[model samples]
Target: MENSKMLSPEQLYEKKIHVIGRITILMGIGLSLLVPILLWIYYGVFPPMDNLLKGVFTVSSFMIPLSIAEILSFYPILGSGGIYMAYTTGNIANLKLPSAAIGMEVADVKPSTKEGEIISTIAMSGSVIMCELILVVGVFLLGPISVKLNSPMLKPAFQHILPALFGSIGAYYILKDWKLSVIPMIIGILFSAFNVPTSVAVPICVLCSIYAAKFLYKRGRISL
Candidate 1:
């Protein structure tokens, strides 16, 4: 029973991390689905199986592909530990993703490295804590916040939140690595102008930019 003799501390932790992460994710999913079923049973009003299937299909149709695409895109940035924490807490795209990226950048840690992975996890964990605290505080403040939020002067700001956030964050990344930015920028702009979907444009630009940078690096056009 004492496998500790065969493994180093780091290896032991890594194994534990993988097992715990998978278990936590599965448990969270199970609980989420179970709640609705329990409510249906308690109410004795289960919907038709066909209707349930339709609902599942409707949600899955968008979510499944988007989830897969996001995992591929975000994996390099978030790494394994960050992925576990982010996925567990949810909000990977808007909250966890930006928090991790910005944290790594501020710490001068490049993504895909061990340092980057730890920093990403730390950043995302902090974000999750802050978000939970904010949610708690928000419940009491929502009444007043809603008034200001609904004010005419604030509508534009609210409407532009995502754009402002992404624009600023994206600009920072592009500026930080301007050479890497060129190809992706061009691809993103051209496809967007041509009415490509955001989802399609994002992944396409990512792949094109990565290959483009690699090609440039190999050709000695860009260093590092």
Candidate 2:
């Protein structure tokens, strides 16, 4: 208690974030399992242990590695509070990541800095709330929306949404530091040519970007 009182405001804030983050993570896990547990109890049915183990193994084979890679790649940008909220709410790559990036950009905050962390957390919270509200509204509108989305003329445009979204964001960063972007861009092109799965490509691209930045910084081609 005395030590905490002696700590700086930033230190106290970090301590609180960690404690609350852990509690929320545990609660999220419980909530995720609640529905399945309730259904199991009501039906008095359970899958065989072997079948469950096989299912777990199948998913874990790919998901564990992908999850580790995502954590490594995203942690620097998202920070503690932001990461907790983003992971809790889901849709990290498509929604939370873009929202955080745009938020920090608009606020002119560098990632990993105190300002960046606060902005990221706020952005993620907003994204989650907006997403939930959109989903609630979408439930009623889905039938009509799907019909329009599946129309032949609109189908082609819909197919480009992810590319358009990422491209706009990527263009800004690439322009900001073209030299640092070179090696990673080349690697990304190669991966795309090879039809690499995003789960596998993400970690590879992250590693390339790190090394490329280091090389450029050392050679006096780029600066922090």
Candidate 3:
């Protein structure tokens, strides 16, 4: 792994430029979709809330600032992609965000080659999984507590935690090897459409996809 601190000024500048560019693009896209997305969510959650305009305004006021702060601050603290998920989930139950956390600790390792990048990616995947597992457990516990406490707001928002976590993983793998990665996701979705039990369908689809990818690679059908 390449040491981030050892990079020359030019390389550091280039990396910063890349990060900034991505941040800007994402912010733009996020803002563009913010209103309609919030409105859709508002209706989904409160179908009888007839005051659509008021609800839209109220939700936007909260979401926009939260989105901006998350984009600007989360990455620096939590590491790449960490803040986004954390912010979306509104912090896990018992696992507090570290005060001096620098995202994924492994991300600072420089990736100077394909092997390095793969290793770094794997390390990052592990860090994210660890954080997500903590969150899933937290939410599972919190769900019942919120119910007992009669906190209706907390229940609905917390329900998004799992999907957002898994969606991040799915997006990462799909981006890495769409042709190979998508087969499993496709099968998973199809099985899910048939009302298959999640416990059975999810693992089968994921394992099938993984082994199928391995088989294809071994036969030289696809190259990473």
The most accurate candidate by lDDT is 2
Tens-place lDDT per residue, model 1, 45-129, is 6889999899989887666666776788798899888778888888877789889988998999988887898889899989998
How many angstroms is residue 158 displaced in model 1 relative to the true structure, after the best TM-score fit?
A: 1.8
lDDT (tens digit, per residue) of candidate 2 on 1-224: 99999999999999999999999988999999998899899997788999999999988877877888888878888999988887787889888888898899899998989999999999988999999999999999998778777889998898899999888878877887788788888988999999997768878888888888888889998876
Q: By TM-score, highest first, what's the ranking?
A: 2, 1, 3
**Whole-model Cα lDDT per candidate?**
0.83, 0.88, 0.56
Model 3: lowest-lDDT 10 consecutive positions: 93-102
Better of 1 and 3 by lDDT: 1
Screening candidate 1 with a backbone cut-off below 3 angstroms (N, C-alpha, C), the clashing residue pairs are: none
- Choose 1 or 3, whichever is better by TM-score: 1
Show model 1 residue runs off by greater than 4 Å.
Answer: 44-52, 221-223
TM-score for candidate 3, residues paired by index: 0.34
TM-score result, candidate 1: 0.82
RMSD of 1: 2.7
Spell out the clash pairs found in candidate 2: none
